[model samples]
Target: MNFFKNIIDKFAGKPVDWDELEEALIRSDIGVPMTLRILKTLRERDAWSWVTANDIAEVARDEIGRVLPINPPPIRPLPAHPKVILIVGVNGTGKTTSAAKLAHFFKTRRHTVLLAAADTFRAAAIEQLGVWAERIGVEMIRGQYNADPAALCYEAYEAADKHNVAFLICDTAGRLHTKSNLMGELAKVKRSLSKHDPNAPHEILLVVDATTGSNALAQAKQFHEAIGLTGLIVTKLDGSGKGGVVVAIQDELGIPTRFVGTGEKLENFAEFDGRDFVRNML
Candidate 1:
């Protein structure tokens, strides 16, 4: 979205222009507290004196990279028998679509993928996930409407064990972050699944919609605090949303953005590359 070019234009080769820089940061939803911290760091080193507009842009990019967990999270292949992956997020955050794309990604890698439609609270959730499972030609374990999602998870884990699949991906129901009971329900699912495989739910991938802007940071914070997320997947980056929440969450929580869902297509999901992302933002 020309994120870098816009930042450079705002700088205009100015000398320590806090107003312009602050506007860029705020618009990017870096937040006032963190934005000021970065600005203070820049000012203390007299960066504005020697840094040109282009140099300032580079510095901005570098600063983002530095604050973020520069090291990428390890993408482990199917561990042992079924490497369980628990996917969670609020409604309208592309949780279902991401699950399908991820399954396709692993299927292309030749992993025996098993999808669990544990979002029984929403009938459409099961149908949607089922559609993707059929499309990918992978097995799916599901339950009836408003059925016990935790039970569905348990069944899926058992089925994965019985079939000896390479990976078991559980698609949880979408609920708001503010709903404590719903979040608690997710915790229950994790605990229930762990009974079958202690090391199960190897990865808790929290999906965040890039268009949500700063709200993405809040979602990450809430989800991480609630369930100890292993990584993040930002969706809808293909649209004009700035997607700067990736920087905010990385800077704040250090939870790596493992994947970015660029578009609606199955191939749109990609591994989050720090170097390419920096280049894109600049």
Candidate 2:
């Protein structure tokens, strides 16, 4: 979160060097478009000749604030059916864990939550969510390895409806964003879920590693284009101080980040707040 401090320190006692400022902003992984926007604002300022490091930080925070939503609406359960949330991401992005954390998030609020181990491509994935389900004291529907994930999710919806569950979170198998076959399979899952309720998968959330920086933005673009993403779950933000991807994705794709994982523990996960995020950057 203090990553912006580096930029502030760099120009602490000197007039802002346009080239150095641009490089610093770009290197922060806020994306080229956002970096350029910040620079342009600084150049057009009334005090452009004597802008300080603090001024740079203020402008950056203001621009980022403008791009991000102050408060994205929270996910709420439907009245007649369970609200389905599909957790998706590229390999090694912590999709399963985030799904579990999300379940825990709702359960803590005293809402009935059901988990679907739809990542049938990986045997360990099913077991992993099972462990969390047990710990969270919730029911989980799982299928065998290599099973059709679309079919598995369809069945999970029926189970959720039968038990009057408030939320059904499906943790889908991780795949490379570049693979059309894998992405198509994801689209199939969305379609299968919709069979129960036209909008069965009420939320499609993409989990991304904040440390991956600009690559996270690219992944969001591909996933959003493939099946349409409703929001994002950004992870591993406790250490990297690379939360700029949250702003970058929101700015570029107009996909709001709904949640963030600050650490490995379940409690580390929480809803995203634009104002708090901008305030903590320095």
Candidate 3:
């Protein structure tokens, strides 16, 4: 956030105190574990001995980049057939919207994209995905109210092959961690994907809202522990401006962030660009 820049500005001509650095880190939502690590690095560098604030800033940016690898890891693409992706998260985290954004991204790459509305638990969720499919000009597979989510994924997989699509994006119902039955349903969806291809649900992405602050860490830990998250998509970053949470996530789970959402429009979503992101947040 701008707090980091403020720290750089305030201590321009002053010695870098460990206490003040710790306070700024906590204020920026960098978890204590990572903050302590940063402090240790600075202390070892003799940062308090004779370093300028600009020197401290350079160290800080490098430390952040160290924890977060800027390059995207090699992703498993559709191999000889369509790739299936299961997008999940608690409600209000923009899971559906991120799914649409992903569909748009794949479509732009000239891949035939298919959408599945498996979130029948919420009628609005189903409708929202349908509208996005139309706006993005992609095929959608949906079921009647109260249909089994696992069954929906199975049928969507079949439909994708029948239509000769390149990718199938399944939007699951959003529920909190308290809903064990719903969480179990998510596991079943992954299990069902094996019915068609053992690696059908090739990627499982957990969508999170950056504005939730520390709660985002909790959600990431829970979802990652529960159903093996392959990557993460964080939304609402433009509003919160809290960039430290990115470092917090990397330090906590090691699940790399793949995409970021800046605004409501479809074009607002972008591949995680660490250098540009750091500059914008500062």
Candidate 4:
């Protein structure tokens, strides 16, 4: 973090070394295309050889600001049926925790919310989400371990609709993005929900670790391609300062980060704000 400060510290009062600057930008996890763009912009300046680190940081910030949406539309409820939100991610990305926090977020807004513990691949996942549900005072629908997640989600949707819930958050099983078999299972979940309403899963949010840096972009790409991600829920952002994937994902894949998880507590989560993110990038 302190992205700009790092740049200034390394090259201040010294002629900017192009190779070093390129490495720094790339190392920040902003992606190769963004790094090249920043370099190109600096090289186009009148005094290219005399460019300072401050100038580099300023241009990098400007470019990132342009790429990120200033205000991504907030997640809202469907007028008639439950607004389904499918949460997906690979292992150790805090997928289940984010689902609970998201449910808490909607509940605090006075919206009736329901939780679906569809991560039946692991017994502990079900128990974990169940604990969060009890702590948050929300109803959860869960299935037996080693159950079919797609079928479980379909049943959850039916219950949510019957209860007239405003939101139905499904915490899905974590799997590697590269596994076609696992990706196909997610597609099945989408198909199952679509049976109720053409757009039942209104939001397919991918939970990514901010600390994962550029690898997060690859996850986004694969998941977006498989099930069509509507947005992202970036996790573990507190004190990591490695939030560059938020910019890179948007810049490369055009996927806006909808929310961010900064800590373990539910209160640590918040909707992503482009202006605040850009300001903090410095």
The Cα local distance difference test for each model comes to: 0.82, 0.92, 0.82, 0.91
lDDT: worst 10-residue window of model 2: 46-55
Candidate 2 at residue 1, lDDT? 83
Clashes of each: 2, 0, 0, 0
Give per-residue lDDT, candidate 1, residue 122: 73
The TM-scores, one per candidate, come to: 0.92, 0.98, 0.92, 0.97
Q: Give the TM-score of candidate 2.
A: 0.98
lDDT of 1: 0.82
Candidate 3 structure quality by residue, lDDT tens digits, 101-186: 99998888788999999998986788899899999999899998898989989999988988788889999999886677778888
Give the per-residue lDDT digits (tens) of candidate 4, residues 35-95. 8998999988826357877787788888998899989999999888999999999999999
For model 1, the run of ten residues with the poorest summed lDDT: 47-56
Mind giving the per-residue lDDT tens digits that candidate 2 earns over 170-236?
A: 9999999999999999999999999899976899999999999889999999999999999999999
The residue ranges of model 4 lying beyond 4 angstroms of the native Cα positions read: 46-49
> After aligning candidate 1 to the native by TM-score, how far in Å is the CA of 65 from where it should be?
2.0
- RMSD values for the candidates in order, in angstroms, are 2.0, 1.1, 2.1, 1.1
**TM-score of model 4 vs. true structure:** 0.97
Q: Give model 1's TM-score versus the native structure.
A: 0.92
Runs of candidate 2 exceeding 4 Å displacement? 46-48
